[model samples]
Target: MSKSVRLGRGVATAGILGMLVSVAVGAAQADEVVKIGEVAPITGPASYLGKDTENGARLAVEEINQKGLVIGGQNVKLELETEDDAGDPRQATQVAQKLVDDKVAAIVGHMNSGTTLPASKIYSDAGIVQISPSATNPAYTQQGFKTAYRVVATDAQQGPSLADYATRTLKVRKVAIVDDATAYGQGLANEFEKKAKADGIVVLSHDATNDKATDFRAILTRIKGEQPDAIMYGGLDATGGPFAKQAKQLGMQQKILAGDGLCADDLSKLAGDAADDVICSIAGAPLEKKGKGEVFTEHYKARFGGNPVLNSPFAYDAVYVIVEAMKRAGSTAPDKILAAMPATDYQGVLGETQFDSKGDLKHGVISLYKYVGGKQTLLDVVKQ
Candidate 1:
């Protein structure tokens, strides 16, 4: 071959090899794995709720992966690391530490307010974004942790909504209050008490109970004596269910008021016919009322083989919110995602989600529900 032709062919060969190497490097960069942590009470009394939360997050991750995700010009695959906190604060902190150690990009939960509060400190210290799907205690955001955020309305809004419904709709003149003594139950009860009093509904009595207690006869007996027009129980459906059933057995004819914890699909099974007399409030719009609520429910049922319980939709929305933050930040780093969170305006299964300075939802909605024919029926949706 001629010397000039030989030199040109060699240069061309080197250029092709360089191009191949660049493509390989780009392929490696595109196959990035992003880990997300999910902590919930997956084992103990609140297993049903925790499992539902996991399902919602898992579904979101699956959909994202299937549809493909590209963040910062890099293809990202999501992996969910789920841990069971058992609805305990101590365990929740431990789970938070583990996720931090594992270097997850963000976290989706620590379901209950009790657990979420303790876990929030760990995430804040680690500079990771922690989004709680169901925790409603106003203190969760009030702690001034930029890392903390929630999709639902706070007890500050929920309690007042329930109080308004009771005063105007139920005409509850005198109402007795009870709490499970956990942060969630106590915080909600306290907010309700404050609002109920402001609305001129006389507060008859307030009592404390533990979440594990299956029987509330002692408190029920004391409450019955007070003859309050209504009874407000601030706790989960697990305890609230039996509490309502026992109140009926004790011949207490007053309607029972409760917060989101007591509002669940299985309350009818837990309280039987007594479920009919229970009125409750959820800290967000009814799922059916959201823009994408029905479609999300259908997709959820198709994937999970049943309807979503309380907060599952919220959990699902949390995942999308986190992913949207990642897209906006163009990075999966926790700090970047946290930085992008405050300005989030993603619309998901829930309506538009935006956070205030305190990481609380800017436009929160509280929905009231009642039971009829052993089914939870929506009464009203109040914007707060």
Candidate 2:
């Protein structure tokens, strides 16, 4: 062929190649964006709780995106939509509805049980899958909401375990209970009181307080007179820290027992020297003690510049669970994610996490811990 003809053919081939590259770039830009919602107390007193949980979810989203995941032959990008509930039930419902309206594929939040329980109905009604990272009230899972699930053990298991430890191990004959009047606080206190009484221990008094109360002097003073062997507090770390501080100031030498809410490093900051008096129970095994937990802890600290407060690891796992479901269903539709949730047997930072028919962790773990040298230290792990 002549030089002119060969040059013309080469130019045509180059033009076709450039056109194909532009089409590929257009397809890449059109990648589906999957939004995962997170509802927690990102403001108010429990903002730390919400922030910690959000960090985990954010981290998971980042890690997943880094891998450039593809679902059903379509390139996908995961996006996080976080809402602050201020740890309030009414606010949680509003946030839940907003997320539903935003059309999120799944949600991981409403950190407190009180918030989670009421907000759960909103998610359920809208058919959005919700996996709470904290919220341990047994009623949450027992309500028979197919869309509701939690990654932690419930108060039913945590309460009985704590009661057994007090009666059998601590040998406490008398106990005083104080709850913050929230669903989480009241439920935990009630369950502990029942189990303690059933174990043949004498109950001293059951006191109630609001979660926002700063001065617990009156209730503390009244309970001081009772001289109970141990005082069990049913509330989050925000209140729990101050409660322990006041108890110590009152010269109440009795040990303090509480739930997972008080198991964070900040508890020591809030309680100061009084943190050592606290013995708290978490809904799952101590993350540091788990096989993969230490690695997660290191990664979290490196990314967030601090240790995880409460259920951050679970929150991270919750995000993974949603993604796993998405992968299994080969779609990001809400109904498809819900359908794939029941068969979730995810091996995460916490180990093999399987859900039961009620959307509760099948092999739930309730780990007990105490503050040693102003740091939370794991004492025991109970499988329920």
Candidate 3:
């Protein structure tokens, strides 16, 4: 072919590619589609919780889209994008960057504190609003990030309550703590130790476990010898199940307490009949009364084909909170939503939740729950 003809062919190809690019950009601009990103465990030891969180967020988005997003009446729609961080903090940061690159309007459903903490900074710097449904570490809201928010009680409330039950109720002078060493685990453990010590309970020993650990005989044997009054665990039920069985086999049959991490019916499944005597505390009030959590339960069951795990519905509420803040700000732009979040008060799955100055939930009270007959029964509500 002639050089001029070859050059013309190349130019025509370039023109086609440019047109495709324009079409993509134009489509993005045309959609009044506001994007929300979700990062959850999805594939790791805690995938069950991840799946629940995703369903909650997806359900909220579905309702929002169906209702025709009325933010300034621009004919808005909500588009959901999800990424699996597998409950890893480093992976969570990567996913956060991906969301920022996609230019999502907001994010919800980071289920782990280890993942949520690092990802929060990325959201803060990029001016994206992020609401975590299950991150209970006190430091999560303490980080001073204007964009970070949570819908449940923090571990600061849960840990001490567990400690109180161990000390005052169970009358244990010496105790041991086993933690998974993540932000959630360690933070709650630290609180337990502090409160237990303050209440005149001696901490006999401390141990560590990873999230999916299967063996606890070694730790249980050691704790058994120490003759701790009780053992407080700081991880989720994935590890707590085996921990309970081994503790019973080792004849530690004393009080075993845990935070919200282990407060699920699945935990009862893991511990079997042995879970009956266990005393666990959750970060939020138990779904005890019919009034508060019933609507959320019914709606979630009908839509998601299952029940909300622990506080997964809190994430569903967080999604609405962010979207409502967007409506209040009259913009999906991050800075405006961030500024408007503190003023957002929405009737939600958890309760009528409002954010304090630090963007933490302030409406409902935290309570202590105990396992009995394979069910979580509310023991008491700590009024402090």
Candidate 4:
């Protein structure tokens, strides 16, 4: 063979090898797996809410994988790394660290305000975007962590909405307040107290309770004696249910007012007949009232064999929001996803979502509910 011809053949072979390497690299990129962490109280008293949150995220993951996800010209597969924080702040931090070690691109939970607050620092330090679907304490986002965000309104909005409903709609004159002493419960109670006092509703008494306490006879007895027209309990349905049931057992007919923690689908089962006398507020609009709410509910029921409770819709929306950020950034890196989050304006099951500078929803809604015949009945929806 001629020397020049041999050199040309060698060059052609090198060009073919380079093209093959490029194709292999593109194929590898197409198979990239993006891990998303979801932390919630999946095993403790708030398990009902936690499981709903997991199911929502799980559903979103399944649908995304099924419909196919492509980011930056590469096919991407999503994997959810779900952890149970058990509703404890300490455990939440541990779970957050685990997710960070696992190198997840983003996180969707830490359902309770207490847990979300502690876990947020871990995510922030790791440069992961942490979106809480249900944590409503104003302090959750007020901690100056750029990674922290929540889809729901804060206790600041929910508390005043509940207080206003108690004063104007329920005609409440004197009210007794009780809180579970956790960040969420106490913060909600504080906001409610501030608003209720400002609205001219006399606070007959203010008391504290623990989230795990089952017996409330002593507090109920005192509040009953005060004869307040209404009682506000700042806690979750796990404890609030029993509190209301016990109050009914004690022959107290006063209406019970509470925040989103007590506003759950399981409240009727937890409080029995006393659920009827309970008025509760959710930090977001009723799922049925949102643009894609009915469809999402039907899909959730069909997939999970039950209706969504509390923040499931929000959780599902959070997943989509994260994915939207990935698409906009054209990358699955955690920092890139976090950078895309601030500009998110995606519309999903809960409606349009946009975050403020503090990572709270730009436009928040509060929904009120009352139990009627062992079912939750919507009373009103207030915008904030």
lDDT of 4 at 146: 94
Tens digits of per-residue lDDT for model 1, 148-224: 99999999999999999989988889999999999999999999999999999999899999999998999999999
Scored by lDDT, model 4 comes in at 0.92
lDDT of each: 0.93, 0.90, 0.82, 0.92
Tell me, by lDDT, which candidate is best.
1
* TM-score of each model, paired residue for residue: 0.92, 0.91, 0.89, 0.92
Off by over 4 Å in 1: 1-30
The residue-by-residue lDDT of candidate 2 on 215-272, one tens digit each, is: 9889999999998999999998889899999999999888999998887876878999
What lDDT score goes with residue 40 in model 1? 90
- For residues 311-373, what per-residue lDDT tens digits would candidate 4 score against the true structure? 788899999999999999999999899899999998888778999999999999999999998
Model 3: runs farther than 4 Å from truth? Answer: 1-31, 288-292
| Residue 280 lDDT (model 3) | 80
